[model samples]
Target: MPVIVLEASDFTSPLFLVRTWEVLSGCITFSLVASLEPPNPLSDLHSTFRIFCMFVWCFFFTLTLLIHILSIIQFHSLIPVSWKNLTMTTAVLGALMGLSASVVFAWMVMDHGGRLTHTVAAAVASCITFLAYSSETYVLRTQAHEQRGYMGSNPGLLKILQLWGGCNMIPLVMEVVHSQGSASGLPSKVLSWQLWVSTALYGVCVLMSLVTVVVILGDLAGRCFLPFDKCLAAFSMIGVLLYMVATVICFTKILQLKELGNRAPTGVTELIIMETVVASITLLAYTVDLAFSIKLLCDRSHA
Candidate 1:
């Protein structure tokens, strides 16, 4: 068992963490210069903007999750079609997933005093859970495909899974995820066991992140902090980015395969918004984490 500890300073407060996190994570913490706050440490420059962002993030997260169920809906033919059903499904599921990840990351940050062992274990557990979700997402899509002959068969599920979770998960199992390659060759259909480039591209990123996490944790307790946890922060944040990129590539392939073309998918923009929110939330989580790591390294160096 091991645990990562946060050494907090008297002046290093939550307000500082949140602001620094927002800035480093890419939000324009500084609002219009002509605003009325007078550039105070507690300025409310982006007050309205921040609130809007938060609302958008939560909505996107939850909607994505719910939309996961829309896979069961049908939309096509001369009677006029609306994929809104499916899009909404994705929104719902995406939201749920976003929320879960947020809770876990926030909990980790807020309870930084916990032992390194717990943090390490929790991180591993969370990753495993996500992997499981990935598998289920695949299963759901596979099942929806066309409900094959057998009692458990659902071809429709597979078809949609290939659309939703299937694409990204494939990269997880195959390439250095989050890389840029044509998404057309997904799910890594092994043609005589020869690996697909799409698979390899995404798999490498994933493998690298996994190794980074394990290596960093190996010294969790002994290392002074900053660098060790920075490794964790890097691995985790990079992994998030990897997921976003891979998922996009996967979606493109699915769309192409389905001949979705330029017309925007019903909820694609919403899904993107949701993913962006998750990215922001993730940024906050890791910023708090590695920032503390930075503080620790600085303190130790001065000592």
Candidate 2:
């Protein structure tokens, strides 16, 4: 029979406290948002944004609770992943998603006139939840040097940022594609190729980051035939080139739409603009990762 042990110290840890705040604030956010009655009928984009925020809150709440329970029971070892890496990944992802959700929910409420007390409260709670998650990320990051996991390192954290940026680009790109013809008064086919290329680039970024994170967390980097560090550098270089192409495509398309007198619905133009910004930021992150990878390689060669 296997013995089950409880670690009281885990409950007192800063990470645990941060997670507790995340759970509570997340609960408050969703609860308040659920009670809100939109003063006016919401557009598809607005409704989607609201639902996304609620989903983020609910999903993180459940995930944080489960993590806490596993820690309390000291059963995290049963999972094949590095516990530190898992927590760090969760913290980074949760912080990004929470911040995005908070911004979206707050924007939606304000756009709807911001008169409802519950809606405003929900937005505030969402911000608090974002802060909690951010704090958790900071705490985890500060302890990264103490852990052997790759996720505790700078490049590993940047990979999470790249992943988040890629995820953000996908939906925004999709919305841009869906609204292309109607928004710019041009045929969808006119920009179809460009949009599809952007989508493919974003998808590739997400796929690469996800694969890298999985390899690190699963401790499979060493078993790979190719040197993991070199592979990561190659991927980062590819990501940079792809994102550069994506950025140019995005901006050029946006300029063309503007020149054509954009007729995009409330949030469609914003979505396009947001996609461009995310692509640029993701590019910057990839550039930094490439630099870090090079530095690591140089250091190893010197040794």
Candidate 3:
């Protein structure tokens, strides 16, 4: 038997490039924001939170940058297997910072008599960034070995993912649309179509996810309609298809509603749409990678 050598470039994919950009851009943004005047000069609480948020972004993204550099250097074995933990930490910190910054932005809005100013816009951008990172973390979790294996120590992990998609992700998408729509002040007429379609698709996904859980459990109970692995893969493919469709619809509506050139909406709607598009693409890439890895694992197991 010949020994196979894996090179650093072998693991490099478009997703890796995208994530590298994500971390580097975030670092630059944080640096710039920190160098500027406080986000809200009048409110000490707001200014403090703004600084804190920038710090969090800087720290998290810098760590991510290091991780990528390690991967690029082919120090694969030196990289922690618990990489998902770093993602989870980043997600949690982002949530805290986003929410805190939102409070400051909200105060600014009320202070300015409910007008959508730059501060409000910044708040919305922070929220969208938070959502995007959270979604990315979800995708990262899917790639972890802990999420694989049907009869391993973590037997309920796959079931948990199914239920999470049904119970949490579907609702989360709806909330994101609702929030962005409200922020954009989109007309009821314009909101009806994309809103309806996206929600409907997510609803289907939710139902399918629930059915998948039941089918998987039934298979585990020895009443298999198909192999558990096959069922899981089928559900993953179908769910990804529906999700991508809904995400596309959402992106379309955002494009339709976006103002052009100098008259663009200074609110958070445009930023939310842009961030969602990036996150959706990232999720799609992650799903494809997961499928490919699973196939490779299956092949290896058979051999």
Per-residue lDDT over 67-91 for candidate 3, one digit per residue giving the tens place of the 0 to 100 score = 6665566464444343443344444
Off by over 4 Å in 2: 1-10, 34-51, 185-195, 257-266
Candidate ranking (lDDT, best to worst):
2, 3, 1
lDDT of 2 at 171: 65
Scored by TM-score, the top model is 2
* Candidate 1 TM-score versus the reference: 0.26
Question: Number of clashes in model 2?
Answer: 0
Top candidate (lDDT): 2
Could you list the CA RMSD of all candidates, in the order they appear? 24.9, 2.8, 12.9
Per-candidate TM equals 0.26, 0.87, 0.39
- Scored by CA lDDT, what does every candidate get? 0.36, 0.79, 0.51
Instruction: Give the per-residue lDDT digits (tens) of candidate 2, residues 1-303.
Output: 575765676667897788888888888888877775534423333444566677888988898888877877678989998888888888888889888887767766566567567776787898898899889888877763766256767788889999888877876676677666565577767678757876787898899999998997888888999999899989999999999888998788778668766443555666777778888888999999999999999999999
What's the lDDT of the predicted structure labeled candidate 2?
0.79
Model 1: residues with Cα > 4 Å off, grouped in runs: 1-209, 212-263
Predicted candidate 3, C-alpha RMSD: 12.9
